[model samples]
Target: MSLIPLARLLPRRRSLGRSAAALAIAAVFTALFTAPAQAADGRISGLGGKCVDVAGASNANGTPVQLYDCNGSNAQRWSLPGDGTVRALGKCLDIVDRGTADGSLVQLWDCAGTPNQQWVVSGANDIVNPQANKCLDVRDRSTANGTRLQIWTCSGQSNQKWSAPGSGGGDPQPGGFVVSESQFNQMFPGRNSFYTYSGLTAALSAYPGFANTGSDTVKKQEAAAFLANVSHETGGLVHVVEQNTANYPHYCDWSQPYGCPAGQAAYYGRGPIQLSWNFNYKAAGDALGIDLLGNPWQVEQNAAIAWKTGLWYWNTQNGPGTMTPHNAMVNQAGFGQTIRSINGSLECDGKNPAQVQSRVTKYQQFTQILGVAPGGNLYC
Candidate 1:
């Protein structure tokens, strides 16, 4: 949901008769009370566009509520259930002592439906506690994780403005097939701590093919297929760089003009799909405008870039197969075609059924989690 600045929403009054004033006031009240509520799921974007999160993804009462880099975990999902309470992990967001004072710490506690836990969304996007008449404030206006949350007099400052279901967060649904941070985490719980939700969101926003190329079902399946291959490629994204160090120098293709600008050894496989080969890096860099050809380490250093590289391969390259993974999915070519597109020479032709099965299993699990049916042609 978008936030409107309070200053812009203020009413400008001109000289008017009492009857006219009363009619205007009534109209304002009607508009205020009748505004539609935004959906309850998604990120709660706050200061610095960071998300309000449950520290450590904990469900325990008293867990600190703080702003953190959005990682798309269950810890960041929030709901403003109509009972006037804001909730996460099925717990109420509460103040330390129902304190009306500024700087009172906010924490998660069992929902008691008290006035202290009740909050209302104001026109300026401040989450206001009716009892205290104060807004949920980010202490010290810090953007760092673990920064304390507090209650302060409504100021309409950026620190106090918030957008719900979070800005740039949520599931790939009917319109766009972008994966929600929650869905990504579910598919790869063991993903490297660096593979964050914000990063993946940025990656998807950067590349249109993954989510924009197909039908909603195809979009979901495409995401599943890509991540499944990514899982197999990097062992559930556990390894940031290729495990076999010997392959490092081998990735530099001397045939390319801008060959291995980061150094011959720098083009080794890195990121979710284990991007390798100097030519691949050059192409991905050209498409992403990030100069991966000159500094492939950017993939390892930046999570969003890493994911972008994976999507680049999935959408553009066919390798030994006849079609790109993007086309294979959008055209209903089956999951086996995607595996072949990614690594047909190594895993297809009955050369490695076990490896093929590994990819298929991950895809199946992901499709089930996404509540989609995995289509046919399970094997290459």
Candidate 2:
């Protein structure tokens, strides 16, 4: 069971039994994750080597954390078990009493796993509070004992640097794309079970650049923007097809060279973004290699195909706007541009503020859950 010997046995695994090889791999993982994490039982020292200490050695819920001399006191003993919290005296290092602002003071509070309690030790040695997008800073840059700590704009100043417990381990972030499956459900709780998480993830392969072409914040912002617009399109993914049956037959335009072979009423709005027009079905079908024009019903039938049709329009078509929704997000055009790209002419420029607000509200809520700020220009 000793890792040292098991690790040595890994390189010679071709000669070992299958059970031995599995054990060696297990040993590797155990060593990687079970090692004593940094700051597991250490004092987090900042400017002037002072420990990040809890005031008065209190275990109460609202105790203020302060800069104090490194006495190895119980108050200075801290543990960061790599779940985004700096723990001491059985409470979490928290942003207390005020909103997540630049000057919010730090405290010890109940470990609720909220964004206010999340901290990440970056490569620059600064402890960042993600909700406010600020760093754990020394108030007034003071090294004096009892100087309360606060979250401030990170300038990479010496006072902002700290030797904390872990660097790469923190609260769970977006693993693949910015929208995790849990977050997707929260964003669309009324979504049809057909719009499975597996379907969305599988569709990501169709558009290689979507939600994957920007910084972490930008990635999250783009995801929020996309999901918000689609939420409007599908009524929170609750509808697999357009409701009004009267407009169903009108989506087929006879002017196209290849007319609606699936009949006039076949190409109704369907899927996440709803491929409605016959020409649109043809285009999406060609791009996705799925004969959607000939068989428009496929969008509502296959979950992954449904998501792919949605991604097709989002990444390629501009609808009534100048840019695709994908380009709007990755190119720094803001969420407003995405709205324009999705349905701007009808909803943009004060024509339908209520509808625009609906999308913006969802985008804001999704971004909040993703632990990122929603960027500006949210309205079309």
Candidate 3:
């Protein structure tokens, strides 16, 4: 890949000369690498760990648990019980019907080593069901906690949290977090939460002008970082549509000169980047030359639009010219001084600094997998 190549994937502006230093930083970020142990295990950690509840699951001696959340209870305190059972508070984490669908639910059952019943913990802290060689997963890490756990194709990421028994300082609840299925789609298949490998393959086949560019290697690191950040924002692409759209309710109802409509009016923020508000719609639309309000859902339904919105936020809102996205992360604000910025509140909340920083630490795990240096910038 050329250090400075053809037209950038997204538009760039000159007024943002302030971003030049940051871009320089991002460009040089390509030298970083992943942890050797984690690489060997195929696990990555950075997304807030998923909380599971062991409620109703059996844990007598060897029974496994159906993964759930910790409502500040002991049932959720799971550890690896003797044999294959996941011993928590006092229960084990068992597989349901021994079935492993890249995205099916995980249930607690008797202590049995049926193929689906066995599981693996990777260096990246990802829990994998030995039966399918896939990681445990959640639908989308939906804001609503206590979501069900399932088995899905694996992609080492922060959302998939695990802990080794011998490792000192391990969380009392081992293997509690699982990856979001949508995240898996974005990584191996979608080319890092932004472009789909399938889509790229089809585009290459259909468009003679489309070049593999072999740029995948160059962008691999950046793509990983971008996906991590997005995972943090969208909770694993559970709501792809809302994850990429703009916030609604243009103005605070009481503050608006004209009262805003009720109900549907508040459903503005949608998609991965959560595009919201008439102003944001106009801004994104004008930037991409699309009429967003006319079709609010376009941002999520169209991959091109989705990519554009995310990239636009990266350029316009986060860090323009900062190709690597490292500096832009700081914009996440108190979330962490390290996070350059965030496109939506769905994840960062733009308030909790500790949570934001922790997420950045998780994003670093993915970036490391792709050879992106911590605190370093990346470029063509």
Candidate 4:
């Protein structure tokens, strides 16, 4: 996720080139390589310690597949039937639209035993789609959550390497109050399986401090508060990208050298936290080793990447706010400070009490549901 300009509501031009240098490089590395032990049931781990996950964990045809955290879920399980096809959820992992070009999307389709659906593990760890003679690549060599899987020429990059089942190191145990699939669904019933448990787990694994900081009670409160804010931002995860198309063109900042590779109108607010702006996308992408500046739509297209962008903001950025949201929660500065960290200038100090209260109301409800008390300072 990229940064949201605090000046987004104001007339002034806001720069999204905030320094992400302070963010831990180790966290980004861990996110890309953390994985569980190979299970008796075939499960492959790839870049960012993520399992190749079926979108929404659905067995339905045309379901998309992306990299997510290894959660020992059936959705992460796969099987090579030795017929040259990778099988999951009773379907074949296929190249979408029968596209042979670089960066074509991958999806689950009915097992027609076609050549396009067949994959081979080359000696260099490339998951080669024999039809196009291209390797299954983590789009843009990204370790960022929700980065789509595409087929590119074999590059021998870490993003293209795959550790087959029963190989590699042991799985890292998930610590703290991990959010369950049922609870996530309960919070956003309309979301169904779109916001997947494995995706959230993967993001959390990458940035453990987001929910694992401080005491268990504090951890739960932080998790609840973060989700509450995210829910409010996304309207319960119903919308993937910002609804207004008019504001899309305003995100590009031509002053930067790499200036909006995707498009002038790209980099609109997207994903759970609504990451927006060109510079923010570039910084976040650089830190996570993903090329979001070149492909900003990956946020809305991939759920894991979407959640990761949100968490990236919550944990690393202070923006126009005084403190990072992670600090506010861990230090017991109260939820009001968090609101300030996120959009204080616009919503805090009686600027927009209604919006502040809306966030607070969600936090309170989430705390109640998580069985933790919402600490004081609910107002900005």
Candidate 5:
């Protein structure tokens, strides 16, 4: 029951015979998955890598992965000998059977886990086959392109050192595990690329108290949910388009000196949440150390700054001792604020205010799903 068309949105399924073969392979994978290994995160050393279901990272079958200190974590659990060839979560990773050259896409498939899905881990952090002689390599070292896995020399670079890093509780670091620019767009059709820079990831890693809520389970769920909602609102990670800006410019005056700049301001919306208008742009710049008025495009250029603006808005609207602005549809309520911000901004015009019932409806919807008040922790 997806919004996009099935034929366009999903990959096709395999035939019956292929399905049986895949299951047989699954039996073998399951046996391996349960066996004790030198590096026990349920991972086998010197052969296959682990699988984590994070976005813009691992693909279905032929997805390239790396090795790390194994802990039998779900992110690391892999099933190689299964009905489908390369799989995780009971789905397969597919390599274009007759793919050409080094950058061909490695996609997911239904496992009949065949030779294509079967990879031999050679040396440290290298997926290779003594038979094939080629090792797993990412094409052009371009994290921007989707998962185009191919056979290259066994150099064992970071690009080749992939792991199925699982998502568990607490807030994921600002720039945690992300899909490469290429893979992000491929996985999500009609979407801009989602790339997480190393700096933000490192920063988030350091600020566990603020980034993660201290619970791995809740953190993972919240991270996934947050990414999904924000991606929908921001038009992927690029903020390339502003679908909700017709009414919700959040400006005091469109014609005022401090309104939107003639060429910019409301022209294209700035920052991650795309703060628009002269007032908000100036405010965001002041708060986040960027002069949005002087140079509006910086919002897209510096991802960390873009995120800072979104966080600033969120904190200002909900942080302690702060008053919620009339322009901001969502504020001071936990998840409710996120929902209201998303829902209300979708319909608000700078001239007119956000509809209360619309925001309330979204809040109710989120509450029902999350089982708590929206923005609950932030408000109190």
Candidate 6:
């Protein structure tokens, strides 16, 4: 958590320094009974977020697997590559003695690649064996540690649920946008067509480390903060390009060597963060491998590029503040710091409390929609 800083990582900008800050601070999935190979390894958590562990860190065949605290031990680590095998400590998860009926015990054993060793993820995080048509579940529906595993009728209960690895710990849709499209609609009911949801999602590929970091709470908060600022800047995702025509020519800086190749007025406020200025366009362009200097209008025309430009600033630029907005939220520096990072020179420290409060209000409302308590430092 100490590395809390940055806006863009893996186009997700998560402060994991990689997570979804950049939740979009998002990272990690695949699907079907086993999900994706990308989702197979690490730890399979079940029953109160505990990891599936090899008992006593054993490697011998027939060792039992149980729910234990996530200790990152080799015993707790597992890989399910959708090859029909769940492996750990050089062994496969198997049913005792190849028993097929209910109450068949489960344990770690040498790889057989048989039906007894194969498992699948199905129905809302359930780990099942298609051969058994039964779920890999907790024995006796117990939440206690060291509880054994067994096959049981699928009742769609919590204990029967299993979170595959690479699921962002507990998030169901890993690497997917953290904000539901419905929630997004709710947040920006009047959003401009230029600022499409698909655009933002597409843009996430650039900052792969953005939201793929930290605990679940930090990930969501970073995502919310980023969206809120974008909302405020774009006027509820309304305007695609800056409105003031008079300010257009002023964005170009004559002193820079590159000297506004796109024309003096091309580098104007545009996109989600309302990216402006020739130097800014050059910086973000250089970072993104796009030629904003020659085509500043691309920010207004391309939705993904526009969103990417905004993310590039968020995950990188400190603006007038000391830390990037991504870092502020990841570090629990309070929403106030994000404002400082974004436009604190103009809005914080009593410069424009109204503007600051406007952003804060949107942040509060957005966090409410996301169902997370807005952490402290709500204002600058």
Model number with the top TM-score: 4
Residue lDDT tens for model 3, 284-352:
666666666455566655444554566555445543133224333433222232134452222233544
Question: Please, what is the whole-model Cα lDDT of each candidate in the order they appear?
Answer: 0.71, 0.74, 0.42, 0.70, 0.40, 0.71
Q: Give the alpha carbon lDDT tens digit for every residue of 1-380 in model 5.
A: 11111011111111211234533553565465332224334343332333333223444444444333344555445554422233455555445573423444455566664555544432133343222223456566544423345655333344444432222222233234332322323433433322223212322322233324534434432333344434444544444334444433333245555555545324355544555555556666765555676666655654444545555554344222223221222222343334344433333233223333333443344333434433343211
The TM-scores, one per candidate, come to 0.58, 0.55, 0.36, 0.59, 0.36, 0.56
How many steric overlaps does candidate 4 have?
A: 10
Best by lDDT: 2
Better by TM-score, candidate 2 or 1: 1
Off by over 4 Å in 4: 1-173
Reference-based TM-score, model 2: 0.55
lDDT string, candidate 4, 75-100, tens digits: 87888766677888899889998886
Residue 322 lDDT in model 1?
A: 82
Q: Where does the lowest 10-residue lDDT sum fall in candidate 3?
A: 5-14
Ten residues in a row with the worst lDDT in model 4?
10-19
Worst 10 residues of 1 by lDDT: 1-10
Better of 4 and 6 by TM-score: 4
Cα lDDT tens digits, model 6, 1-380, are 12111221112111111122322211111121222122334878777667788899999888888877777789888776557677788889999988766789899899987878876553246666645545788888676889888876454445666767642222222446667667877898666656655456546656755655677677778888999988777678877777667777877778888788889888778888888877788888888877788888878876667888888988888877888888888889988988888877677899888888888999889888988888998888
Q: In model 6, where do residues sit more than 4 Å from their true spots?
A: 1-175
Instruction: Tell how far residue 278 is off in model 3, in angstroms.
Output: 1.1
Model 2: how far residue 232 lies from native, Å: 0.9
Off by over 4 Å in 5: 1-190, 194-210, 236-239, 243-267, 318-334, 341-380
